[model samples]
Target chain A: MAQPDMTRIEAAGGRPEAIRLETLRFAWPGRTSFRLEVPEFRVGRGEKVFLLGESGTGKSTLLSLICGINAPDRGSVMVDGTALADLSAPARDRFRAERIGVIFQMFNLLPYASPLENILLPLSFAPDRRRRVTDPRAEALRLTGALGLQDDLVTGARAAELSIGQQQRVAAARALIGAPALIVADEPTSALDTARQGAFLDLLMTQAEAQGATLLMVSHDARLSGRFDRVLDLSEIAMTTRGAG
Target chain B: MLLPALAWQSLLSRRITVGLTIFAISLSVALFLGVEKVRTGAKASFADTISDTDLIVGARSGGVQLLLYSVFRVGNATNNLTWESYQDIAARPEVEWIVPISLGDSHRGFRVMGTSAEFFDRYKYRGGRGLEMAEGARFDDLFDAVVGADVAAELGYRTDQQIVVAHGLASFTEHDDKPFRVSGVLARTGTPVDRTVFVSLEAIEAIHVDWKNGARIPGQQVGADAVRQMELTPGAVTAAMIGTTSRLQIFGLQRWINDYPEEPLLAILPGVTLQELWDLIGVAETALVGVSAMVVATALLGMAAMIFSGLAERRREMAILRAVGARPWTILALLSLEALLMAALGVLLGMALLYGGLFAFRGWIDDSFGIYLRITAPSLRELWVMGLVLVAALVVSLAPAWRAYRMSLSDGMTVRV
Candidate 1:
């Protein structure tokens, strides 16, 4: 239902400045009490900024809103200096597909699919990114290699066969493979052992640095806070955008 | 990813659910295909009535009824055509051929017919060719007989086997003295002849010489040989097959026979009579469609419950999807695709099972019920129904899919931990 004249993804392409978010307040209209009011959040150009909050403080909600999943009820969330709330649902999806890569704690990989297939699943929906890549499979392998996954693990290893740490690394490679400007990770280290968690974090940060994409890693683990350039606990930033809890 | 691929994996992972669903859908497909098969069978039997000859002449009855009793051996004719009338009718200038058939007799639970060599050479049921001799040739001497394909198979009769005829149509022998040699066996034609035993008309007259009112006379005996030598004079024939000079004269021929003054007669075109008979068969078709539709609908209902029941567990999965930049719409598509895929697999599985069952039991069904369900590849109608099942499954999935979308978006990145 769209004319070719309206395609915007071609103009922005991939760059560190592509995705941006400002003071944003999101409300769930029907469920009277459930609402997320994030007043300020932004991941600067190629900045691997870690955001922290406890389990129930809407840390995941804040990341999703910043990533343009749920449009803010008030204020604004901009990616590449364009207000995300203003775009249509399909446009938002296309935008996310092209310029924003999201990673979840569980990795969100389809169980029966091999790691390579899981890595390529996101590209299926993002036609623009698919076209942009000279060869997406090669790009996926490169990302997987940079994330310290062995070449053998990329082939026949299914998501269920991989350990939690390995799955997290797969999730990271999938996110960074498309060369999207921003990658959002949600409690990705929580499922791993303390030893694997540090190694996993190191691999993820290294991959983000290599891709030169902004990273907004959400976690409640305060011990890991010192590694990032700036660790902003979500609550401290929310006061200005949403006056109270 | 293509929907089927995802669906296939989902189904493979959930073996029990998918198996149950497939079982449910296959039964529905069988019911649907079964109705179509029986309808085709009835039409085949009806068409066998007048395929070769141009016309059928018999005592006045519904054109279809006359065709059924005379050609297909379905029903009995209330009025009999006198032998004199048959002689005059067969003598008509336009009548190129005639095979007078005298019914009203039975042999070991099969219909008994009495006729001459012309009955074997000229009388055609499905096409112009006469019945072939699967074993021995047609009867040459009187009292020599050829049994139908089914009768021979059922009775285990081979060439040179001798069988006795019982008076009337009873299953047991009443006056079984007259024995006839089985000279030939006919091919299976899926018609009444499959259950008939053929003998010369003289044999029929000879066998009954001692019988009166379907019983033996007080003190009379007529040997099979002596009975055949007597002057042949057939009193009545149940029906007669007539061949016209041209197809264009069919209407005129029908009118002429129906208006005959000596004996009331009815003539019917085989194709048209078959179409009318379908009205009677249509009832079963309607019932089958209804039952199969309910089955499919109920299976979809089961699919819906399977999904909605797992909604609580899937909340986390949907949240994960949302985290991976899957829009609410994507979540809906994913869940709905799950249901659509299951229903589709069920339908396909159902069809395959139906084909298998038919392939396995076709012989038994044909033997027992006189019907054959072909395991032939599904036709366009079956495909259309399968397609409908997919669409229905998709629509059926919409409810839980919408709910999943809302649940995911509301919970967002933070599901209730």
Candidate 2:
């Protein structure tokens, strides 16, 4: 594992925090009974944090807000010192593509695309991210090799043909491409066994650290929290009472 | 550009569904084009049947009826025009040439036309193209006959072959006693003339001399040789094709023939009567076009239904795309482009099928229906139809595209499915 380079973080921004939220409020439209409120949340720059929550605890909603997929009702979502509310919908999508990389729990790759194609999908959406890599295909090949994906599997096999563990590694490579400032993983290892989960987390964290990026992974399993720098419970962060699951 | 590539790959992933949908659309397209081709081909061939003739003179009756029986040989004439009337019209200074035609006889399901020997020189078809013999010379002997291309080919009749003409339009009453020798076979004309057998007017009068009232007398029979020495000038004829010396004299000559005091004779401009006949059949053509258009609509709607139903299972795919920084509009464009590609392929395949079918069936259609389907490049109207189908496909695709857009927006990186 490569060590984090402090010079890159200082060049990106002098600020100590990677993500900050203040007085956030959100609710689903036409569903008046459920609401989520958070007073404050922060993740430091180059930090590896674990967010623990069961299903139906607004774990996905918080990730959506941080990625700018959904706008908060009242407060601001600021990632890498840029306020998400200040941007238009398309700009927010571009901002997410350039600054944030996300890995879903399962089915993180397009089934029909080859593994190399899935790894380079983000560059297709973000010109800024594409400009960061001088040779996109070579960069994708390097990332796939670092993630233990064989050249034949990356080139010849479709994403659907790979095992679940291989798919998660490809998804991790996709998330870490172009050295995005933030990495958000939503139970990325939930389908893996305990041994593979720890091994996958080690690779993901090492890749994030090498890029000087912050990792925020949300999972229901508490046993995986020991490896992270910090852990936060969703029930403690969200100040509102649970209305409906 | 990347989105269209993605769309293509996505469509290729589900080959069976996409292939079935394209097959349905292509079949409908082929049917639509086929109907349009037949409609235009029928009209063109009908208009090309006869040309350069000023007027068709027959007994006083409907103009369409006169044109049908005299030119198409489709039905019997209600009455006959006297030979005196024909001679009177032919003597007028405006008449350049006149060919007398006598119908009401058959030879093996082919109409037998009794005409003057000069008919070969005066009659014209397909834009003033003169008749040319394929085998031998024109009829000269009293019992000599000539056959059209189709008649000769279909019945295997060669020059000098003897054939018995039957009285009336069917084979029930045969004039077997007076068999005529085939003198010539005309070249193919791609008209109703190709289906007729021709003989000199004297032969027709000789065959009917002993017959009375559509039947033969009990003991009266005329030998083929004995009748050759008698006076064979026909007293009456079914109709005549007349050409004028000047184009300006056609209407005047037609009016004079219609108002002649000798008999109730009708004269009609060939072009005008042909238009009237076509207009009468235009209603059926319009109905056929309408039915084919509906079939196209149905096929397009089926494609819409197929894509719309597949969107449900694709919710997770949409979420994955959204998570990778694809906007809702990107998903919308991707689905719409997939449908457009399918429609374009279907159209191309349909054109190939249409031309292939036409090339395979051209001869059969000409022989069976007398409609010469020219295998030419697609007309502007046909290209416009394909363009309209693509537009329709784009419009129909919006339904599924809009649905996927909404799904990607709402699902937003975390679809439950």
Candidate 3:
């Protein structure tokens, strides 16, 4: 399995695309009416892409597949040059932890933990990510600081005590920690007002660019597409429609 | 370690429910341990009541009955052994020493035991510890009385205080004509010996000189001083405790006493009879232990229910953890860790409550129930019970932990609830 992927990754300038999906087919077991198929999809290294999709359009399902939380029925999901289908379940989880950082639309922080603690949580599970930082606490503080969170709020307040915008910024800092090769955000700015949304996106993009990580953010909002290097519609990428056997 | 920290923080977040669950479990643990402590304490004190005595000779009856009446001062003897039989047993070459006991009297609620002054010298309790006077000397005169510590404390009787003996358990059948002076007060023995009033065998005869058919003869009342002057040889005694010259001769003497041809008599080894008594009442003790164990189980189930119900509200938390790279088993471990921590806390708090209760009520329990509760480290049996409780908690915790594991697996990175 590694032979072909190694050659293909070498063919792609010696550094694999951040995410590559080829002839991907998926369907929730016991739900035969809804199938998702994508002939080809790719995100190059350090590329910022906006994935536009509405609710119930297989957006979360696609993210789950990319994260190796769900296996594809056909073809392969290669993230950072490794084939997810070739790894064991636990190895795939480790791969996700080491190479991909995910931010949810809401409730992205553990309510009991401080923002600084939340930002450092991924390191607690992934030693590879933890090894990338010289000092975990100092790095957490730096990331939160870069995301516009105050030192006091990041250090003292629980994640639940922070405002909505502050919490999203904290989540952004958490997703950007350890310089993971890919950052996947699922409608991360939906909970924020229009002004805060644009500002949060700018800060998030700036942080991603500074880390030189690819960003694949999914949202239905079209106005935010101009800021990304490339934009793709979920309907255009996924060829199968619901209930169309 | 991170899982444990997360579990601790999660528990702390729901401190109210968690605190109440811990308190409930602690209460049950305390009850379970308290029952076990009192059971063993009562058994130890009962066994400690009389030692070094080879046999207790009483009129033919049940061995447990003889032990209850002769040693524990509980219940009435079916019949009394004649003074001649007692003398015959005492004169045996194998007998080292003997003390005769005459019952059927009371001062207030305390049983009045009439025995020779040699009883203070010959009888032993709590592993050969002799009786020590807390106030004055043992009874010497015919009308002199010696009270146990609890009798003196409860009735406020001191050396030289006068007390009239009742004919039996009834308060109205008092031998008011021959009031006895308290000559001594014995120190606390943590046994039934601490609840008795001792008088001379002659004193028992003197008090009943004017009484017949369980009542006083009209115009035949004997004054206390005159009764002391009269011959007071006891015609019969309720029982006698005998010590053999050698431990090897005890069984021989016991057999001889039990087979005495002149009278229907029973001779029992105090230790054997005490064990027999326990065997008879062991059912009640086992029932008490079972009930307490059930209480502990109920409290632990309540804790499991609390955690299981809390799992529904924690789907988002599980999703967040999974999104942060925690495995499904980590979620399972987190729940189990939480349960274990609560159980461990409950056990610690329960021990504190048990020791605290013993410290506060040790004297009162000893006085009221004649069972001494020593403030020492927990026994091996008690530690075993605590260990079992933790194991049970861990076992019960697996139900919810497994549920959480399944939920986290299926709800990967996206929990609807």
Candidate 4:
């Protein structure tokens, strides 16, 4: 089922917003005191935005809410053009699997899987994503190679056997393999040294830009903020994004 | 399908503990199935002891007592029927044939039965199979003896070996002076007949001619040669097994024997009496099954403990799966699939143990005890029990599956670990 490139470009001709959140209010189910309230947020297509928030400042929570991992108490999270809150839980999982690529902090790779297997795991859960690739293993190999992880290392080594920086690159290759519409990096460079973090960020940003996917990088480090198009501090959002930072 | 493969890989990574859990399950399964096999086997062997004999007639007593003494050689007979009564029963117009069995003496704990040549010609067991000699000719002399297969094996007796017949049941009271030569060794029938020693009725009469009131006369010692000069007619017999001329006449003949007037007599149908005996002993059999079932439960609990302890470590793995778009139910399915694989492997290993154990110990069991357990395929009841065991293990394993489901929901792509 090959759709013409004309139709894909037409479908991509949406309101030009990759992610839009309006009046988002979220509180963990059991804890009513801590909540995240965002009045307005938008990330343009292909734009790289640095979200600056320290640990516990709802940085991970915001990423989870945006990706449909956790639902907001009262808000609308529109990814691409669909509202995630309107879909069923299972449908939301499928939506996330199909449209969003998440790269977690270090040690997030499946420990028992090889680098290539880790990269292909999202496709295992989401067949639509798998259908997007002509050959998933080859795509994984290309991503790993472009991310500066050696071909031999990615092919032969398991996640546990790889160094922390290598695992981080493998995680990024995994996120970029299926070329989802949005790439969310949740403090993914926290474990890498300052020298390697910059290189890793360069590779990640280059891959996201090449795929025409919007990038949302969350971190407390302000030094890396200058490399992005815009920066949003969590503290200035509202009283809702409280206690975490 | 990919989730199951992933589950397999996770289990393989923890191969040592998983292997041990499988081993525990297999042992319990083996013991559980083993007990059932022996229970059914023993029942079959017991029911098959004297199949063709329509009615077993003995001195008046409880039907179980008569069965135990006459067929199984278990307890002493309460009384003996006079030889005249046996003759009258054998000569009846409705009788097809009769095998008069005299059980009292023993040869090294093996029951010594004084039966006639008709025993070889007419007696049948294990579905109408007659005795076939394994080594030598049948007993034809005055004192020639036919030893059973088990007796020959355990005592190492062969043709022409002189075996002394003990007067009483105990081995200490030996009839040392008058010994009988083994004429033949009977083939194994895997029945109580395999443990009996057979001789002519005349031989039994000659051996105890001088004994009165269960003790020997101090001055009476008859030589083997002199026994030929004396008349050798058995005064009484333990019991008589009768086959009616027509199958329809069996009930009538049983009623006649039960009402005999010369001496009090009890007559029983072999199949019915065997079932009664089984019912009497089935209580212990049930306890055996219950104990083994507990053993299986303990093994499953051990598996649950192993899975529960590993859950804390696997929370991170669950979060990773959820992050990659695996639903909570997918995590649940993965855990359940792991348990099913372990149960299937355990059942296969238990079947192997059952058949292997039966094959290895068939002979020793037959020789030491007369219970013959065959290496046949599992019965439907046995298969059902195995199915129940699998279901139970799966049910026990769901605890971890539920925990994983809840953890995946709460963790939400952010593993605390």
Candidate 4 residue pairs in clash (backbone atoms < 3 Å): A56-A244, A57-A244, A57-A245
What tens-digit string does per-residue lDDT give for candidate 1 at B1-417?
Answer: 544565566567677866777677667756666666665655564555446677777888788788777766766889988888888887787788888877778877788888777877676655454567788989887778999898999899998998888777764545467788999998876667788999888778778778787667877887666776787677888888777888787788878888989878777776677678777767876776687678778878887888888788667666655655567887788788878767766777777777777778888777676565556677888788888888888998899988887787678766664
lDDT of 3 at B236: 97
Residues A68-177, candidate 2, lDDT per residue (tens digit)? 88898999778877778878898888888888899999888889888888989998988888899999888887888888888889889989999999999999999999
lDDT of 3 by residue, B349-411 (tens): 999999999999989998778787767799999999999999999999999999999888877
Can you give the lDDT of residue B344 in candidate 1?
67
The regions of model 4 sitting more than 4 angstroms off are A1-16, A31-33, A238-245, B121-123, B128-136, B149-159, B170-177, B187-189, B216-223
* Candidate 1 segments exceeding 4 Å error: A1-23, A32-43, A124-135, A239-245, B1-31, B72-75, B127-129, B156-162, B171-178, B210-229, B299-317, B335-378
Error of 3 at B256 (Å): 3.0
Give me the candidate number with maximum DockQ.
3
RMSD of each: 4.7, 4.2, 2.8, 3.7
What lDDT score is found at residue B274 in candidate 4?
95
DockQ of 2: 0.64
Encode model 2's per-residue lDDT on B79-163: one tens digit a residue: 9999899899999999999999999999999999999888888777766888899999899998889999999999999999999
lDDT of each: 0.74, 0.89, 0.89, 0.86
lDDT for A128 in candidate 4 is: 77
Which is the winner by lDDT between candidate 2 and candidate 4? Answer: 2
Candidate 3: docking tier = medium
TM-score of 1: 0.85
